[model samples]
Target: MEWHNSLAFAQDQDINDEFAAFREEFLFPQNNGKDVIYLCGNSLGLQPKAVVEEITKQLSSWQQLGVEGWFNGSDPWLQYHRKLAAPIANIVGAKDSEVTVMSSLTVNLHLLLVSFYKPAKKKYKILMEGGAFPSDQYAIESQVRFHGFDPEDAIIEVFPPEGEYTLRTEDIVAAIEANADDLALVLFSGINYYTGQFFDIETITQAAHERGIPAGFDLAHAVGNVNLKLHDWNVDFACWCSYKYMNSGPGGISGIFVHEQHHRDSTLNRFAGWWGYKLNERFKMTQGFVPEAGAEGWQVSTSPILLMASLHASLQLFERAGSVAKLRQKADRLTAYLEYLINGINKDLGTEQYKIITPAQQSARGSQLSIICKSNGKKIFDKLLDQGVIGDWREPDVIRLAPVPLYNTFTDVYHAAEIMKEAASATA
Candidate 1:
């Protein structure tokens, strides 16, 4: 689609957008009493208006029923998490039983590693992307150490060829094959947080399976932002945080997806707790651990009702929006418009003042574009922030801007680009 660098064009596009009304559902941060351009959904999404009502209902339940709230309330606290399975499964493309909301992301990652990262004497190494989120790096390093393997010898990172900003699919597959003999597991992010590059999960999983290695994903940036088919893709396991593109509040519940194939495998180990005990016999106070079938078996503690309430509110909106496919449709166009407008700035200035390091192809990226400022990057970023255009700045020079389909409008992208253009000229 051809993109125009004009405010009227973007406003006209907004007029025709079917999802335009969805933006009203969120409470955007304000600047000078008006909503600021919130392009930072890649970090934390705007709050849903329904979160307050849902949370209040739960608070009232506690007030009226006290301890009895576990069984007596209209929405029983005992089975609160059961309601989340279907909606979350839909978002991540898994069966209802294959998905469950649990602890925070990193915590869940460590728990999942217990089951999936089984290293034999010969096959003892893990392969991953070079610049994975720091939390994942630390988790893998510690897990390797726990197994008596040095991190340097047990962890293999596949990096892009020099002068490149992203990894090619072929390179990733080759790395998996090269380390096939020693690889106990292959783990990767569904999308790189820093570059917004969405990896090809299906191909990567197939490659690992051929090498007799289990493949897992950290979908923190991919679950709600891109199309996923974790079940059909035959991925061994995956986990995601709800706060980013899912519009759940900060530190909201994290979710996990364990393939049905792993559900009945008793050989796997879990750091079991009472919550994962068989649901029907949970109150029996049994002496031994018997996990509930499917992903729910991974739960280690009682549900956090307040956090689940916030997540449920957001999932309802996602359901109303039909599917993640619908969100991606609008997201692609909105993000493209931002890219087009930025390129227009460079053309007008008669120089390549802004270089977009993110993949130009839609299939390889989501809504974010990581731009490298040729000069005065931080000063320009600050100027945009002072003007209330809220995209996030990374260290040194890059600015990560995301056009979230659920809450951001085409006009918001237009205004942000306008402010950015002014910043470019002013700083120059």
Candidate 2:
């Protein structure tokens, strides 16, 4: 695809886009009476237009049915979460039985760690990417302490050598092999939240399995942004928050995937609760715990219907958009175009004033491009925000711009770049 910096070219792309109509499905934040160029889906997704309708239906069920809503409503509260399994499964490339929506991301991570992170004698360490989201670092550190191990010794983080911003697959695989004997688990983010680099999950999973280690991922950034195949890749366990690319509201419902191979493993440990009890026997209130088969067995509390409703609203849009594979086609082009436009800005300024740290390869990234402003970094970011170009800024130097395929347009990208150029020029 030949690149153009003109607004007319962007308009032409939008006119030809098959998913162009999806832009109207979301409600964007306003800045000075206009929709801000929303490039922050990687932080919090825009609210879906159908979210109100979905939540209202649930509220009405509660209003009329009262206590009987659990079983008597059109969409029974008891089994409401089951409806989400198929659609959520499609988004993450897993079988319905292997996936379940439940507690928040960090909570689910701790729950899964209980089952998969059994350290035996000398084999007690975990391998992960360095500079992971702080929540993951905290969760892993706490889990290690809970088992009476020093974090500095038990958690091995693989960092990029010196100046590189992302991890190479060969380096990651080598680290796994070098520490294979002592590693109890291999946990990684499907995409680094800061760098926007999508790791090779299948290769990483295979490396761990060959060494008899259980492999898992935090898909908070990768879930709806890139294609995943947890079931086919033989991932042992994984979890993600839906508020990001899935377009659920802030702090929305989280989901998990436990490979079917472990679903029937009676020896596995879990923090089970009444909600995870065998459905038929749940009302019996039996003394002995009999978990419902499959990933549903991991549920620890009653389903939060409202959060699920918010997620259901967004999942419907994903279903309508076909699959992540299809979304990625548009995402790759949009990100590339944004990359081209940013490069043009630097060229026009006659120097490298903005440096993109995210990988250039389509296969290695998702919808985001992380840029490092060489000078006046935060000042330029603030100016972009004031001008209604709403990308997120990280500490020190990075600004993340995500051209989401669902709600973001080529025109949005073009306008955002123009604003960015103006901001950079003003700083100069």
Candidate 3:
């Protein structure tokens, strides 16, 4: 696999991209009179062109089917969720039965905790990363309190050493082992939302299982960003949002995974609702809670048909891409090219001017490269936005730039760097 090191190389790669035709499938924002270089797919993916057709089909169904839409219509509203199971399963690395489309990410997180986090008096602690997403932090705090324990004592947040931007694999393993006796569950993000660090999930799962603790993940940033093997890794359960890498719109449906081993455990507790009832006999309206087996049992509300339709269109595109491996190969090369361009720009500007904080190594991170601006982060970021290069800002000094394999091009990355180099020189 040879790669060219110049802008022409990136342009040539795009010219020869087997998936290049798929670029027209989304709407990219234009600045002044041309398309802006979009590297913020880490936060929100570009919309799929097919989404309009999918949404239109559902609206037509609503108009034509009328009262019969619930049962008699084409792609009945009652069974709408079934259509998405197989495709959603592909991206998350699980069997079709092991995955299901459901509520928003945070909502699914709370529902999953109801079933997985069973803390005993002796083993009452939950393990997580210290700087998790703010929403996750709130969820953990409330869950700990719900268990009749104070968060300060029941939730153990593992942290990297001082001055470090990410956690080491060894440090994470040690934290799990040291707290094994009292740890009830190990819940973590597959990719850190801010730093773009990818954890060694296999090692973490192995360590947790050794202690008889169930392991789970919040894959909000990772489901579409990285390759996974949820079943092979024996992860007890996991949840993810599709709006980012899946190209679904804001607040799109989320997904869940549950290994087969736990599928029939009636003893595991859940906050039951009508939709979770056995699908075949759900309309029978029995007296007892006869939960459906597999991940579908986690569903608590009626399917959102319009949203599922939008997601279905995006999943079709993923299916055509030939799984995560195909996209990953391009991602590695494209992100590496972006890093190369940024470093060259920084060298020309001087070390005191700017720096790339994202990992220099490939295996440790995803497409997002977080750059620490030398001076005002917000000012530089605003200037870039003004110039039509759109990236995202984190807290103090880092700007996160993500080049998505599905729709982003190497040319986009190159142009973003050139714009930044200009902005840095002008601001100075």
Candidate 4:
């Protein structure tokens, strides 16, 4: 579809969009007296309107039932996470048995690494993409050190060629092949947080498998934002935080996917707790750890009912809106229109004042466009913020604007772009 840099075109698109009404499900941040243009879902999603009610219901259960709430409530706290398994599995394209809601993202990554990153005398290195999220960097470094290996020697980072912003799939595959002999595990972000480049997970997983290495992914920025087929893609393991595109609120519960192929493997190592014990025998006060059957076997602690309630409310919206497949149809067009408008601004200014480092191809990116501001970048970002356009700015230069399909309108994109354009001049 041809995109026009006009509010009328945007509004018309919104009118035709089947998912437009889904935006009403969220509570937007206000500016002056109206909703601010919220294009920051890539960082923190807008709160779903039903969240408070969902929490209240859980709170009432606690008030009425006390400890009995675990077994006696309308939605039993004992199996609260079960309510989310199928829907979360659908989002990540995994079987219901393969996915589970568990601890925070980094904690899950570490637990997964313990099982998957089995180093040997020869194959003792972990291979990953360079410039990963800081938490990931720290996690990997510390994990290698915990194993009594020097991080610099035990970790291999694949970086883009000089001056390039995003990586090529071929380069990534080649790196895996090149390090095959010494690689213990191959890990990558499904989408790079800084550049928003969606990695070729299937190819990467295939490459690792061919080299006899297990592959994993940090889906912190990919889950719910992009289409995923973790099980079909043969990903050994993956984990993600829900606060971003999943609209599950700040510090929402994170989830994990452990392929069914790994489910019955008894030799795999895990830091176990009582929650992972077989549910039937969990309260038996068993002397040894007999893990539950699927991904739930990885759980290390009791489920947080409040966080699960927030996530439940959001997943219901995701179910009602159909799936990510339906959302992506509009998401692709929404992001495409944003790119068109940003390019039009450059044309009008007669200069490449802002450079989008994200891949131009739709398949290689999600809703995010990481723009490198060429001049007064932070000041320009501040101007947009002051003008009531809410996007996130990374240190140095990049401003990330994500027009989420669930709640963001094309008109919101249009107005935000207009503010960006005005900011370019105002800051200059």
**lDDT winner:** 2
lDDT for each residue of candidate 2 in 1-428, tens digit (9 for 90 to 100): 99999999999999999999999999988999999999999999999999999999999999999989899978999999999999989989999999999999999999999999999889999999999999999999999999999999999999988999999999999999999999999999999999999999999999999999999999999999999999999999999999999988989999999999999998899998999999988999879889999999999899999999999999999999999999999999999999999999999999998899999999999999999999999999999999998889998999999999999999999999999899998998
TM-score list, all predictions: 0.99, 0.99, 0.97, 0.99
Ranking by lDDT: 2, 1, 4, 3
- Provide the overall lDDT of each model, using Cα atoms, as 2-decimal numbers: 0.94, 0.95, 0.86, 0.93
For residues 1-428, what per-residue lDDT tens digits would candidate 3 score against the true structure? 45544688779888987778778888989999888888888888888999999989889989998867889766888878888887777778889899999989999999999989999999989999989999999998999899899999999998888988788888988998999999999999998888888888888999999989999999988887788889899999999899988888888999889888888998889988888889899989889888887888888998888888888889889988888778887887788888877778777877645667667777777788878887877888999999898889988888999899998887887778788888888777
lDDT of 1 by residue, 140-228 (tens): 99999999999999999999999998999999999999999999999999999888899999999999999989999999999889999
Name the lDDT of candidate 1: 0.94
> Residue-pair clashes per candidate, as listed?
0, 0, 0, 0
**Candidate 2 global CA lDDT score:** 0.95
RMSD of each: 0.7, 0.7, 1.4, 0.6
For model 4, which pairs clash? none
Ten consecutive residues with minimal summed lDDT in candidate 4? Answer: 419-428
Model 1: lDDT of residue 382: 93
Task: Give the TM-score comparing model 4 with the true structure, all chains together.
Answer: 0.99
Model 4: lDDT of residue 195: 96
Model 3 stretches astray by more than 4 angstroms? 1-5
